[model samples]
Target: MRAPRPRAILAVLGVLLLTACGTAGATDGAERATEERVVRVAAAADLKFALEEVADLVAEEHPDVRLDLTYGSSGTFVQQITNGAPFDLYLSADRGYAEQLVDAGLAAPEDLFSYAVGRLVLWTPDGSALDPAPGLTVLAPEDAGTVAIANPEHAPYGRAAVAALRAAGLEEQVRPRLVLGENVAQAAEFVRSGNAQAGVVALSLVLADPLRGHGRWVEVPVDSYPRLDQGGVVLSGAADLGAARAVREVLLGAGGTEVLERYGFSLPGS
Candidate 1:
């Protein structure tokens, strides 16, 4: 081919550079479009079933947002968040814990909202000879073996279990037979796995599918323990505040309220 003039070659080079830049920009835009919005949630173990359902509903509406949930004792989560854990939101079984975050300036006071009221249940695996009904008096039987409860020091459900036992005057009799789980969910597991003959767990957990028909439960009288006013708050250090708030709404809105109710949770103020 004949050599091109200097101007012609310069013009071609400029076009090539512009095309490369355009292609690069398009690629960057595509990458940004596909980037997922992640919301890290620190939730109480009692909320495992209900929150998972809420997450599914949230996904249906906000596919770009991914909810990353960490379930554990509410007290433990409070400690973690206070120490600057990168969680985007906190859902506590005890409302007080979420309030504590606000007091510490880790979360906005206005962002805190009560989501549900948890109830305690006395649960025993199916086919168990023990009858949890009538009351905690069943624990007095000689063959009761062990009763599993979450660690009262950190798990809100555990505290309620203790309170119920005390109210029923069974604390002394059941004290020696107690086996502590790290959280309420683990306490339910202890009973399911036959490690403990019976347990006191969140009513929401008992109403969940796998456990709902797998065992027998008696609702502990509400008067037996302090009400479990569950609360949630958006964290101050959230990577995406809007996304975090969106997830929070999913738990507090109609869809979440229905799911929570289906799982045996009573809505706050209901």
Candidate 2:
């Protein structure tokens, strides 16, 4: 084989350079794809079930984005967010909390939007003699034992339970017997674990797979308490603002609404 001519040698070198550049580009692209894109969300306890489904929707829609969800009372989360907890999104069981964040400048008003209206329920695990179908009246009996509710101090569902009890004229009688949980999910757990005879919990919890069909529950009359009016907001310090906004969209989108509805959440305006 002979040495290549000058023009031919230059052409070969150009092709080699192009190939190397293409390989480098492909490697960079692959590296970019492998880097995990995450969005951290602080959500209300009542969303324990429905939000997980919404997360599935997020996964299907944005394969590169991963959601890290933490569930608790909206009030507790409000305090956490206020104290500078690093979260990309905040989903509150009460829209008022989201509004509170907007007012405080922790989240933008434009980034805040209502998602769903939650419902409260009277729940009793399987084999309980208590008939919750009669509504809040079941708690009237002296033998009603300990009734669990989320702590009204910070939990919206707990506040709603208080309101419902008052509306049913049972506040005075049931107040002394109430067992308060840190959040609504814990309230349900109190009943499920047999620590409490009955509970006033988020309807979505009873409808979730883990508890569904394993117990019985009756809707606490919507009129009996203030509407839940759940909401979500993209935080101002979101690590990935774009991903946070995408999450907000997924929760309010048709697919997310469908999941919320299936889990017994009422949509806003519809």
> Model 1, 1-270: lDDT tens per residue?
988899999999999999999999999999999899999999999988888889998899889999999999999999988887899999999999999999998888889999999999999997788888876889886589899999999999999999999998889889899999999999999999999999999999999877888878899999999999999899889999999999988877889899999988998897
Superposed on all Cα atoms, model 1 deviates from the true structure by an RMSD in Å of 1.8
Per-residue lDDT tens digits for candidate 2, residues 115-202, read: 9999999999887889899999999988988899999999999999999999999999999999999999999999999999999999
RMSD of 2: 4.0
Runs in model 2 deviating more than 4 A are 1-29
Full-model lDDT, candidate 1:
0.92
At residue 133, candidate 2 shows an lDDT of 90
Model 1, residue 146: displacement in angstroms?
0.4
